[model samples]
Target: MSWVTLNDMRTWLVAGALAFALIALFAPRIDLTRDAYDVLAVIDITTSMNTRDEASGAETVSRLRAAKTALREMLAKLPCGSHLGLGFFTERRTFLLFDPIEVCENFAAIDEAIAQLDWRMAWEGDSYVSRGLYSAIEVAKSLDADLIFITDGHELPPLPFSGLPPFDGKPGDVGGLIVGIGSRTPTPLLKYDEEGREIGTYAAQEVPQENRSGAPPPDASTRPGYHPKWAPFGNAVVDNSEHMAVVREAYLKQLASVTGLSYAYFGQREDLLEPLVAAAHARPLKVASDIRALPGSLALILLVFLYGLGAVAAGRALIRSSLNLPPPKGAK
Candidate 1:
């Protein structure tokens, strides 16, 4: 009501603001339950992934490299409490390099591991993509983590006319996404030496032109040179575009359908994030949440309001002095 009382109240308000700010500065995070993800991602390191179908600035990059880049970006976007594991798919199997670990804590190690994935890691030259996807699902199941399988979807020793082998496991048991990596346009599949030196592109005859996994064509018995014992499929060079690598989107989609997984293409930097997050099932996790900022911001706003009030009071005092008005009752 009086100037003295108003001044005292203002001083108390300033002190209260400072106290709240100090508390905010020293406040510790509280434990809270929140939803987080646990993902085990397997990358296809087969030879077909060496195809340079993605562009980076003025340079073209291999599908594997582009996948790694997208993964690194995704790693940064994952929530702090979420977990991520890495693995390499080759030789009809997915080999788990490490179990799922907290993403934020082991970010550097996870990033370095992804960067080091190479086609030479394959022990065998065969790329059975369907089998590899199944293996990845098993690995994820063992760890109780969601699966993220990144591949160009190029199957070596092509699928037989009978189609992919039956998946024994129940579909949708382990949920996640199958990320297709590569362009639709066919590109020459690059060949490399054991030492990891790029030699040249594979010729059509160099790769399997037709499915060899099942019994030879039904008409094999009637063929001219068909030998049931030795050349059941007939030793003929089939002219097909098998050597050219492309993203088998349709095949990958079929695989996704059979496995109860979602499908996404790795094109732009942000392409993988949305599908990945959508595929992830939220698991409750205890997280240490820092709430100090809330009170700190409130304190800051209060201080600003107090400053405005002081400025108005000073302006009033100045105006009154210039007008030569007498001091108000109980004024200091």
Candidate 2:
């Protein structure tokens, strides 16, 4: 009776394992309802983004490098059905490199495109952050996709005293995330030659010290050497802070408020996805997910377990025989 029962148990285990193995061999797929995203990601390629304020392991990396790394990780995390587009911000405009494409199908092309992004691609030196963001929104709207604008919020030549140029688009017209990428502490902006060789940092005198596009400062008349025609703000005092780069979180938050977009600090690669996904408009997709490995792995585990059980039982029987002990009441 014991022998028959043991054989029956072994047969059942073998049969179950074989059944799962066959199912795995068929490699069936299932259609799942998943939220898919259509996103246009625009990166800041301004000179200020060259500021090395982020630490990667023991070595420090530039803001642009950090942003690219975070973006690469984001690409991998996006699901198969999701679509992604690429663009770069420079000279007060966002230039779209490509329209949205399916992530899984065109991952290599998308990653290669991102890897090729360079500060040298800037058509102009000025970084009009607000205008660039507005352009990004327009591009995203044209593509019917959400926007992911990554920048340190550094405005080259500085913004006008009148505040950001009026946003032509209505708030909440396009949902997206504004990812601020840099440290709070200011660091000198690195200057690079035409060939992309870093020479030195921008001097305080070389960059704009204040807003010169709008109305003069309220105290402009009281400033030293204040000449309405020549020295508007002042000729004696110049703020050098504009020459340095830092993550303007407050400014970015204000931009987010005006645009009806969510804000996120790109401190770590993992921190970007949540706010990004939350801001993205989800479109339901029928995703065909292959589940072959699930049953195949289970089948393998079952077979290994059955083999171990047989080995243990055989060893126990051998020990009983060696001791010349009775097989007990149910023994074969």
Candidate 3:
């Protein structure tokens, strides 16, 4: 199929520039995007998040480290007067480390709080993701704050199809994001000592034997028909042992969908920022909304293009003048 000619490019550019200018000049007053709303950042401190699959160059980092680093950067970018709080999901429940406080005034405390997030805080090996999320929303509801739940979506002894946990809230009742962390490529989950020292990856067979909570790992005798169920079992034997640990994107997305929360991967800064802001429906403190920045940015870009074109034209004119000038004093 044939495409439009180069002439269309100029036409489109000119039209866009004019549109931006008009919008900038005639558009309603736009408010600044300094969203100063209370945001509760719930972090998953489970062992699965301790996976060491995230790597940058030669340096390797745990999923929890990546999360904390990203979160710290995001926290620093949060506007003044924006309230921030911290929570941890472990032992099958969500615990608020502290209540929501303004970022500007309590930054030191918040930063320290984030740094302290560790797998050692996990009271029970069990990670009841659905329950944890439900409890988190309930907590956020009391604070009247937006919720940002960060997790790898590792549910211990994975929930059964017949018993999906109930979400006890209306759609959008608590606006925020369910940020999934870690690589999509499943990697062996690293086991860590109580002192935060890594030992080794959990073997498939070992997964069935270890449960830090001291609760018995599910087997055919305990819960029957694949308690650590990953597949359907009829007469064939299904081993619940072998499974790679990674970011459960599909599960997280589905959970968020049912809970009326947005979902994003905690990889790029934008991935976390855009959905979070949208879900919160965060408004400028000084006004109801704002879009002037959009037009203003477009206008700036147009100016840049126009400036380049002028420079090119001026260069050509100078070249022509020099070329047309009589040979310097009839030499040559």
Candidate 4:
């Protein structure tokens, strides 16, 4: 889309204010909405998570393991009166690990689900970020607590999941924090064969097999360790910090878009969950006053969106000037 000039922007803003004033004069002040302490941890379980770190000799931990550790730790640290939940994506779709629970609450069911994690899902891997997110949003709506996204932060395109309600999750009453774990830079690992031998990872074309090996078996569903033919190889890896930040930013932005929640970046479990719990306790119940009104959230979102459009216009103009742009020419 083209950028709006300062003059045009000012005019648009004025027009908007006038239009809103006319509506507000006859209509009413737009009302906002929110909910109680709901938190959902959306984790990534894509196949690439099996790589070790170059910096720390964290050979015992892969990305998924690190995430699981953080998740369990966060669960144990959750304060009373707050909700804790887990959502994760593998093969491009999300599964509800531990649906939102509260401290001092019975977690047996959620714990059972957590224990059910294994090599392959009830179905094979498909890994889509958007699908995971949409599922998480649905689960979050069923909850009345602040939603927390515990993730590696990468979003894939939507992989259609069944039994999901119809809505993109905007104009909903869910809010919470996004705690990012692991680096954004990818940590691609060497593939292993079935015998856990370090066979090379899968390439576009199949490499050579053994000497007339008795008809080598079919391709694997899991990571290859010792594919009789391809030898193991490793690539120089970059730090994942940047990708981590980007994935989280994307996830949190999606969270805000779906549910108007302020995404906080806290480090440790205590650092993360405590602030959310505190915010929940102190959460202004002013939104309760708005529920009785008609289409409040929609109206307010429109107003906020209008402000965003103005800011975007100003930003584009600045960018154009930096690149040496002429005044936008048009007949007066």
Candidate 5:
């Protein structure tokens, strides 16, 4: 019972090992976050999105570039265990570039995919905004994921008759938000060649000639009687024309309303993600049990060593006690 001894040290070591063994055997429960739903992110990569208006610090960047930056920030904030998929709107279709995967695990690939998005990926020179949005809804439904549609909401021929697009999906089919990106004042869109090399900005009178035949291009002539409103073909440049791309906030809001979703500006990353957090909390989480085994293994090894030493020491003490022999050096 002296201050401290070899036996005391041995006792403490054995007790510590026993505690670790118990912890490992029981597999302490930890609360691991499980996402209630997956998110399908649809990005618009049209030529008009090349308008350099979105501000980043002191420099103005293209809408597409700003969108990619915002996406990177959003991806970094995605909830743990949440699943995310990337797609792009091109040629009036939502093309799934990749399927839903764990966001945390595959963030690098997601970032790469986001960065690679550009007008060059567009199969055609048409941005049927409404049609692309409809396609996004279908894609989201097929994936059974919540939708996050990011776009400038710039329609090539402006919504025909100024009406909302057809959305048959019932409300609550999926929860999501339409994130609008752009400025109110239009900016000249940077033109690019087929190879995606930047040429120059489209001037007011530089009408996008859809073959100069008063007929929609082959790729954009899919819908019957759907001749896109061709920019007036003439050298009389309308100097006052607001040809620059704008955010189209009203159109985006209307689309969100038609689809039973929310709308938000993409200027602030946190403001956009707040609604996502609410959407995530509203769904039912699918839990996955994770039983870690390493700690238990290490504890067991220490326990074995400690127990062996304790046993040998106990056995020797017992023999000496039985014979009533003199104490060994350091015996208490």
Candidate 6:
């Protein structure tokens, strides 16, 4: 298991105390991003989000809650004047929930829209990821935004290869980052009959969720038998673990490779957020986390420890590269 060393914990404690103690020591400076406005952020409200991956630990929370929490945490760090809009998608078309709004814009409007999200209106698509992605961009065509797409790999829309918008300077520009939430192995999703019996599974083509939630990995026996009435199973997504896992994995890869975009996985990994947020255009990497400014003195100490870990990793990579480490015979 990954761990924070005792020294690491103590170091964090000391740093936290020291920072808090020093806040009054120095005069606070103005935050440039405070005047900034955010762009459109699209979120997935699909049902597969209910599952937790086997890869993430047994107690891992659902994707839906994580998405909400991340947004909540992000809002706290948003630039003061920054505006945020909302969009949602399913297997087919996309729904525009809110128009763009500056941070100073109506607060209740956005929250009410978000709070109004229910499973019924979320719809069922076959996974038109490209369509959903582009749709958000289409709405933001006129305005500059840091578009954020959140989903659990539920679907990939049919994107026309020739119609993709440009980033650096093309006609169509859909600027922003994509955040994918979920795991490679999702959970066993099901569409229960009124009696609550098993049905079929829902997943994108060639994408299967890996077992990561520590639940017993799904076996074929867990799947329902062939049924003519269950045709929707093929088209309608079941809330199985396997599908959601694949959805998250495929979503990241596609956003990275297909769209020339960057992304952060927001499922149960809060530490990862700070870096991505730090990478935002207006922000410097120096502000690692929005919650607080890490002391340079403390960072130097942490770097020393990280160097030791880095050295081990470098040595292993070098050995593997040089063939200095013997391989199991015929392992390749």
- Judged by whole-model lDDT over C-alpha atoms, candidate 2 comes out at 0.89
Top candidate (TM-score): 2
CA lDDT, every prediction? 0.89, 0.89, 0.77, 0.50, 0.74, 0.55
lDDT of 3 by residue, 1-78 (tens): 235533455555677788998897778865555557788898998888888766645777888887887778778888
Cα RMSD of all models vs. native, in order, equals 3.8, 2.7, 11.1, 20.7, 10.4, 20.6
Kindly report the root-mean-square deviation of model 2 from the true structure over all alpha carbons.
2.7
- TM-score, prediction 4: 0.46
Off by over 4 Å in 1: 1-19, 22-31, 218-237, 269-271, 308-332
Candidate 1: count the clashes: 0
**TM-score for all models, in order of appearance:** 0.85, 0.90, 0.67, 0.46, 0.67, 0.52
Candidate 2 lDDT over 1-332, as tens digits, reads: 47676577677788889999999989769988999899999999998888898888888998888888888889998988899999999989999999999999999999989988999899899999999999999999999999999999998878877787889998999999999999898888888787889899988888888877668878889988899988787777687599888899999999999999999998755456678999989889997888999988988888998899999989988998999987868767
Residue-level lDDT tens digits of model 6 in 58-95: 46656665666666556655655567787777665457
lDDT of 5 at 248: 86
Residue-by-residue lDDT tens digits, candidate 4, 1-332: 33555456555555566565556446644445443355776666554444443123434455556556555655666544456676666654567766666644745555555545443442433344445555666676776555555555443222122212234666545655555555544443336565556575544223221222233324322324535446221122323232221334565555445555555543333245565564343333334132323444445555677778878978978987899977577723
Clashes of 5: 1
The digit string of per-residue lDDT tens for model 5 on 75-176 reads 888775778898999768899988778888898988888888877777887787778988888888898788888899877644443265567788667788
Superpose all Cα atoms of candidate 6 onto the true structure and report the RMSD in Å to 1 decimal. Answer: 20.6
Q: Show pairs that collide, candidate 5.
A: 187-244
